[model samples]
Target: MKKLESLPVEELLDQLEVLVDQRDDGKDFLLHSIISIETALLRVIKSDPESDYALSIVKIESDLKEHLVKYGTYLKTEYRKDEISAKSTLKQALRYDQTIPLAHYRLGFIAYKQQAYKSALFHFQHAVEYQRLKPQHKMSLSNQQSYHALLYLSNSALYLAAEAQQQSQKISIHNDVEQTKIDQLTLSPLYKLIDANSSYLAQHAFQITDSEGQRGASWEEYEELIDDATKDALILDMTGREIWVRYGGSAVKLTILNAELLRKLMLNSSETVPLAKTDLSDLFSVQSGDIKIERYVKSISRLREKLRNLKLPLDVIGMVAKPLNGQDTSYYYRSTEILFMLIEYAEGGQ
Candidate 1:
């Protein structure tokens, strides 16, 4: 690659423009473009500092920052199977733009996976703080990342506390005085942080009901009502046969039929539209008869009870006897807060 700085000013601007307009064909293309653009931009900025050019240097810099962040995110997410490479690339991107919360979150996740809890805490804290500082528009990527960061932050704190406690216990066997100091210096502070973040998460994560006592809010109200807690409050992992509720820090096991019913409702759910008896029958491959409705009601009741026992909001699954639609009374997931994984099984699993 010829030194972009050696190229005439006009050619440099043209090349930058072309690179900016280039569609993302693949990771290689993105990586190549990011490197080429960054090399040229940095060189020019250093040498010229101030230049009157056809393409504004400010705009080019902004575009380069975006590309750098994008490539960093790709490396962290898509290429995450190679943990070392992902972390390195993300760190390089942070050197260019430190405000990318997604990069920080990914790095934190990698650190957490490696059991480097302290490093994980640093990155996760940064991700949460930066995400909170940004405006959270409804259903935006920022909002999503904000929720993820907070959850990870809380988990990181929990793990750190556990680690500290273990260390304290080891020290207690040697010197009781040192153990007391360690508990005060480390474990207490970590516990406070974990409690504070967890409280914030539970209060804001999901909006259980609308003003009129409706189960879920519309898109317009979703942004205002929901917060970061919604991300992990409830996770249905079909492949693992796990229903994870945030408050308890454990999975709630359900019968296969009940799990299937919950999964069906979740898959077909709409904020404003509820799935009728006919829909449920089609989904469950059962006859649309009284027995089917009775069975569904019992299954939903059991699911709701399990969720209730876990102290999760009851409105996670909403049922209406008479929806606005002319169909039979129906059921739907009240909020879009629940995370459903391995959805492919919804089509094939029993």
Candidate 2:
């Protein structure tokens, strides 16, 4: 999926225009296009609205509202009254629940684009909540549950990214010289999810990936990184990966801890020291390939001893300590955060 957040303005707007134009172009999928266009427009709204762009967005937003009114009427009249088939009704309900999250996500992305961190937060928060409690669409139990978690993570990432940008002071919204500001709130739900589900998400995302990796090379956006032992390395719990999306038969899996970590991450703001492993097994459970937990312990111990010999703070340096007893951590590390830590623990072996 295209990360809509970083899209160039022209490309994003052009994509939106295409969808919007097609909605009224008398195509068979006009209604679907209408929804798609409307959703994409929310994304565009977060951009700095130049005078050149303002009127167009205003018109698009207006048109989208009109379409919603009309669509709702259709649902009440034709679709209601037991006229529509069960399947059709189900599809509509699912669509309804999906559309809001889609639009809100777009809006949040836009806010980030325009550097309106708080507004972006508002929209993204709505998207996440819509994930937990919603229109209750989708008939299949699994699809419904998956969709709920997927959007929850997706929205959480947007918020997380926004907060990260703020605290890191990397984002500068230069509306004018003196009006710029920072937005801070890190390690939200997605980070927790990554810490907990790093293994499963990596496994699933990699299972569906159709790309390859090379030494010192970046992944092809969709490729999974395999460790020397050859298991799908969820080394990096991508905040975005928690969308709970499955590709083919592969999907990110999480243990009971994954959910709990995510819940706490979303609610808490303090930095957490990672939980140390109760034993190597806990840490090793998440590892794959030929790497044995015993081997990992021996290796880690060697590394620690070496660091101690160097008179370095083994506790503060070298490999990051993980929480095995369940406590603070700079909690809420995205998938990538966990991945980085594992890489260090593995002594940077591919």
Candidate 3:
């Protein structure tokens, strides 16, 4: 076959059609066919020549997003992080709008990875604000994406605040007891927003008038990365943040794939041992060994084991994954005080 670069998009699409139509069994050729089609798409967008190729840019950007969504499970399974090919992906977004909320979100997240909190805050905040303006105009989208965007913005703000609080002089501790009290309250969403934005004031010693950030993170830059959990949660959310990772467990992930089917079954199951697979899938809405679920569970297991060695409460892990029936959804997961502890552990590398 001709290299993707040597052929036109038309040729590639036709080839993709043939592969899709010819496949007999999904397990046998589905992955191969999809991978080939994707590779072709990537090659075409790998670079751009002189001329305004607006069509090319649009196609490539869309392709990148589709790939992310379609293969999120697979990518997540193999890598701890999404590990997107950011250089090319960001270039497309940057070519369009520097202030685009989605663009800002990506940039800010990228910045977060680089430990550039200053830059990350700038990007994340703008992403939230710009996205707030998005409207259906005439018709509503099937999934009003702006809602998720808003949540992400709120979450980012909290994280930014948490980062600042961990630093000195951001907020006067007054005493150890007060600090612990503040930490406890910070677990709530309202406090998280306050703390996250308050970091801006605290960051530069700009006369700390409030407890945390007053304004919040910026959406124009994504350039901050730090490894501090307590603030990461307290600053970003009221209850705390639950990180979903790719823990690489096939059986566990399968349960997640059958989440709905299993949930129905769990409705009738009894007090579980270790946790009935159906019962767990129903509770977490994360069927089997989803990477995110795996990360969460393993993180919890690691926490419990450590507590045992150190002689801390063992039920702490249960506290984190209490599995509230109401909270079972794709948007968020339920957690207890121990979830915060796990986040802290992940941060401290313990």
Q: Which predicted model would earn the best TM-score?
A: 1
Off by over 4 Å in 2: 1-99, 138-350
Worst 10 residues of 3 by lDDT: 341-350
| Better structure of 1 and 3 per TM-score | 1
Worst 10 residues of 2 by lDDT: 341-350
Give the lDDT of residue 89 in candidate 2. Answer: 29
Over 210-237, each residue of candidate 1 has an lDDT whose tens digit, in order, gives 2223132233333332233435445554
TM-score of model 3 vs. true structure: 0.33
State the lDDT of candidate 2 residue by residue for 1-350, as single tens digits. Answer: 77665556467566655653343232313444444545465565546556355555544544454344223222223123221322242234334444454345444444544656666666556655664476552211123224333443454465567456555554334444343333434445545654554444333332121113212222333344332333332332222312221222233433222322332232221234332233222212111212343444443443333323322222222234345654222223233221211211010100
lDDT of 1 at 74: 33
Q: For every candidate structure, what is the RMSD over all alpha carbons to the true structure, in angstroms?
A: 17.1, 24.3, 17.4
The 10-residue segment of model 1 with minimum total lDDT is 341-350
Q: How much is the lDDT of residue 216 in candidate 1?
A: 21
User: After superposition, which runs of candidate 3 have C-alpha atoms over 4 Å from their true positions?
Assistant: 18-64, 68-100, 136-350
